[model samples]
Target: MDLLEDYRRATFFFESGDPLGAARLLEPIVEAEPHNTAVRLLLARAYFNSAQLNGAEAQLRVLVEHDPSDHYAHHVLGRTLERAGRFREALPHLRLASAMKTQTDYQEALRRVETWLGKNSAA
Candidate 1:
């Protein structure tokens, strides 16, 4: 299949709640188009949804490193770290995401991480 077809299929799989299928399809696309941020983002989401925290983190880190102002990347990275039980590490990314975009999800994540950090610091 062509790249576009693969991308469409991967997206369909992801949206249909088959993240592993999406990830499997996306892996080759990512290898072929390393700098394709859109594909990378989708692949990252696939990894995130499939509970592949390490892979998600790696992809998100690359996205954030390439574009610090990418609110979605920051938000996903923060969520990935949070899922890994790294609240303190997730805090800055979550805050940055909220600062870059006024999304309710980002704000909620930032608030939750902040509360966790605050409680931990107080202890």
Candidate 2:
């Protein structure tokens, strides 16, 4: 299989909103090139977009471990956890991502998670 072609197709699938198809195309690429951060990131995003939170979390965890300085990975991991109702576990990751990057989206996610945690804890 042409990995590059597959990657491009996966990217197209993802951009076209067929994340499950993108993920299916990415899985083999990821296994063949485990060290390719870009492929893994795309795969994780596909999983996240497809509502496969567990897969997204797993991929994001590996990314964070591979490169702790990857703020995007941290942010996504936090989001996956938040979506899965693990706010407490997600907080640190969200905070770390926000601290690492000054993106508005990051801060917004952090705020959202914090608010969720607050409201839930008060219950």
Candidate 3:
């Protein structure tokens, strides 16, 4: 199969919510496309869903380093930090996520982020 087909099939596994299957299929592709930011991000997210936070964090740290302005990466990292009760670390990412938010005007994600940050700071 063509590379696109392979990627599509792997994506199908990923979208089907089988993170391990997706990870298994995508790991090799990663070597061939080391600079594929999207792929890296997806793999990181799949790791996150699989409860492999360290693996997810590793991927995300690379992505974040590559593009410090990517709010989605920051958002995912923020959520993971919150889950771990690392609120201090979560604040910056959450703030970045808020700044990057532009869709769903009613969401007020920035406010939420700020609220969390404020709450943590207060404690």
Candidate 4:
């Protein structure tokens, strides 16, 4: 199938709650287009939703390194790290995302991580 068809099918799989299927469809596309941020982001999200935290973190880290000003990348990376029990590593990215975008979701995530850090640190 063409790239567009693959992308459509991947999106359909993702929307239908089959993240593993989506990731399967997206993996080759990502390999073929390493610089395609949109495809990479979608693959990262698929990995994340499928509980592939390491894959998601790897893709997100690459995205952040390629474009540190990408607020969404930072936000997603932070969330992925937090989900992986790496709250300390997630904080700076979350804080940067919040500062860059001022999104409520980002702020909420930052707050949640901060609280977790505080609780853990006090222990």
lDDT of 1: 0.95
lDDT of 4 at 27: 94
Name the 10 consecutive residues with the lowest summed lDDT in model 1: 114-123
Taken over the whole model, the C-alpha lDDT of each candidate is 0.95, 0.96, 0.75, 0.95
Residue 5 CA displacement from its true place in model 2, Å: 0.5
Q: Count of backbone clashes for each model?
A: 0, 0, 0, 0
The residue pairs found clashing in candidate 2 are: none
TM-score each candidate: 0.96, 0.96, 0.78, 0.96
Error of 1 at 17 (Å): 0.3
Tens digits of per-residue lDDT for model 2 on 1-123? 999999999999999999999999999999999999999999999999999999999999999999999999999999999999888999999999999999998999899989987878874
lDDT of 4 by residue, 1-123 (tens): 588799899999999999999999999999988999999999999999999999999999999999999999999999999999999999999999999998899999999999999989953
Residue pairs with clashing backbones, model 4? none
Quantify how close model 2 is to the true structure by its C-alpha RMSD in Å. Answer: 1.0
Residue 15 lDDT in model 3?
91
Residue 96, candidate 2: C-alpha displacement in angstroms: 0.6
Pairs of residues clashing in candidate 3: none
TM-score of model 2 vs. true structure: 0.96
